[model samples]
Target: MGLPMPGDSLGDALAHAATLLLEASSVDDTLDAIVRSAAASVPGADHVGVTLAHADGRMEALAATSDLARELAAVQESIGEGPCTFDPDTAGIVHVPDLWHDERWPAFAEVAAQRGIRSKIGVRLYGDSASQAGLSIYSARPNGLDEESVQIADVFAAQAALAMGKARVIDELHDGLRTRQRIGIALGILMHRYSMSEERAFAFLTRASSHGNVKLRDVAAGVVADFVAGLEQPGGG
Candidate 1:
């Protein structure tokens, strides 16, 4: 659904957008909601995109409202220019009111203009020394975005950052629980099969993990798989 009408106060629209963002069920869903909300709420925002930069120097196009947005994000990543490539911690907001005349990012502006995108804006969503994220809005007309659009986008970016951070934490918690359960099951299996105590069974798994240079969870999963495979053999159960 669209955000509150322009006649309504910006505060009211931001409140509504925040509710929608919080209702997202996963990280992907949250990114999608943020882009959709920005497209609907920000004036002159013809398309929107979200890009996440990981600590390992990986760049991901998390979400986009249109192919144009995705293409623009790719251009920014490949050329290492444009607002999306800015340091999120320092460049909280970057605006290109007219792409054709903008010289700050000549290569980026050339590519954008070729794609019929005349204006663009990027708002920092979240950032740390190792990783960062930003939202990009594209327009087809020169001077398409204004200060009002920037203000509205800032609110949306803030809400988006909070939603994304919470989603990541929830995901990490779920992964942790799953890993613990798998390790526990593997320990039980080892203890029963080798007539060893719980501590010894765990130590065995740890040693195997260290020796093989594999993750503990992966080692545990392999043990569980072997047990299941053995059980499936004739007269093995």
Candidate 2:
């Protein structure tokens, strides 16, 4: 009925953050809330960072406002490992008081330190049940984030993990649908080009996928693309 009294205390702030996490309806919204809450929970935090990794270990930044933070995020992505790529054995609260001294991510730390980022705190966004999300807060001030900030991040991580999981599921389904659509289109092209039945075209694509050690949809798409491109050549239909 009433907001908790405005205070900087960790307990109060965590309660507020927990409430925010509970209210999130989507992964993007949950991440927005998490970042806002991270900045709120910390003492000198000026910005918050969020990232999601593809199945290929390519990390993509979800949200970051500052230019330097965005660049640093891109660097981590290019390297494929950084503070966000922490050991699963880590119990909780992976804290880096100073990026310069953190040897674990030597390249990432060098790049980040040069970018004027002094500290970072990363919490595992996904637990043992799922793997895709990762949360990290980047700070420009030296040794900025405190213990309370880590706890707040961890709590937010757990609460929003459900939404993150849902997003992953939805994303997978969308990708599958797209793959099927592409495969079907490619199969149709093959059928027309080869004067073969749909069933036979599909079988050819499947056999090619298995023989080439490539995905079925990929093989189909490549075949169709090549066939179409041939038709575009001189004296071709």
Candidate 3:
């Protein structure tokens, strides 16, 4: 019933966690694994969560190991500041030895103190991507995130970033495959109805997409939908 812990060796832990990420069935599952790994493996981590900043500037923490972690992340999102707000792309790493006494993020520190969190650690994940994210761990005791803990958290964050990258790549591949399938079906429809060659059909779809200022995939989808609709019409093929 308990989650797996990281191995004694950091490399081994990273490899095992990477394998799990690759095997994750969905993006949610991969994120869940990252949080769980942090909570179980990282020293001084009583709870773990992930804060994701979308390209549209929306921030959210949908993957967390406990309610406390989720609440803390929500507070940061609402206030627009916290350990997870660190720009991993530029700032690299951040370690908060005592949130209750940390003056840098007063609003967040107040909220965290009220929630019984005394210390925290955040390592940016996928910092170079359009969607910035970080892995955060919270503790109820002051000075919990020491140097060793910070090092461990760094390794954990690195592994998490790798997993997130793999998950996104897999999602993009699936989307690409689906788009290709739709385009192929639309091409088939155009060829059968208009007696057009494959090259001509694709060109026509491209021209339509350019003229309409729409994505080729969307244009192809519309063609497929129209073809299907025609089939449902009375005395129509």
Candidate 4:
């Protein structure tokens, strides 16, 4: 999808963005598309980046539309203090009309000014209690983003959050399915070889997992591999 026309409504622009996100195939792809949409929807936004809070409390840029946006994100991560670093749930929307003189983030502001980013706006995206995230828009001109722009950005950020949340859920579901499949295959092997009941085979696998301090799935995988190796041995089977 492309940017809205001059007379197009912000709501319409946001709808288009949601469509693009829905068509995305993965988490990375969804984030990349959202950042691009932010640049298009927000007035005077020359660059955009998506910041993600990891489960470990580390923050990093997930995707950016330009090198400048990526560089700025890295700078903020290094300093550990910037609009993007703030918890969106509490801080709300953060708008810096003039980064060149913003006292709240002196070090970051100074460095950002050198890169021609005179203004910035960070809108919080959706995240769970374990993590948080936001979208950061960069502009080269002071007072580049106005109230209307900020409002539109909020809408875009919300849509991006929904898309990211769904993508993550899908990823988790796929991972869970694969883990179950591996464990089931290993259980079958154990049952066939040992003439044990399914419950007994599962119990054996669980004990092995606890004894080795490994995950149940990993233990299952190891059992399957060993069985395959035995079948391939000379004068074996």
At residue 108, give the lDDT of candidate 1.
88
Top lDDT hit: 1
Model 1 pairs whose backbones collide? none
Task: List runs of model 4 lying over 4 Å from the truth.
Answer: 1-8, 54-57, 87-90, 127-130, 192-195, 224-237
Candidate 3 residue pairs in clash (backbone atoms < 3 Å): none
TM-score of each: 0.89, 0.62, 0.82, 0.84
Model 4: per-residue Cα lDDT over 1-237, one tens digit each: 665554567778777878998888789889988888888778889999988765554777889999888888778778877787645355668899988768998989999998888999988786667767788998999999888889888878877888988898888898899899999999999898999999999999999999999999899999989988998999766
Residue range 128-195, candidate 1, lDDT tens digits: 87777889898899989988888888878988999999988888898999999999999999999999
lDDT of every model, 2 decimals: 0.86, 0.71, 0.81, 0.84
Q: Model 3, poorest ten-residue lDDT window?
A: 1-10
Q: Which of 1 and 4 is ahead in lDDT?
A: 1
lDDT of 2 by residue, 80-184 (tens): 768765345655567888887778889988888887888888766764433345677777877877676666667766755655666556667878998999998
For model 1, the superposed segments whose C-alpha errors exceed 4 Å read: 1-9, 54-58, 86-89, 231-237
Model 3, residue 41: what's the lDDT?
70
Score candidate 3 by TM-score against the native. 0.82
Error of 4 at 168 (Å): 2.2
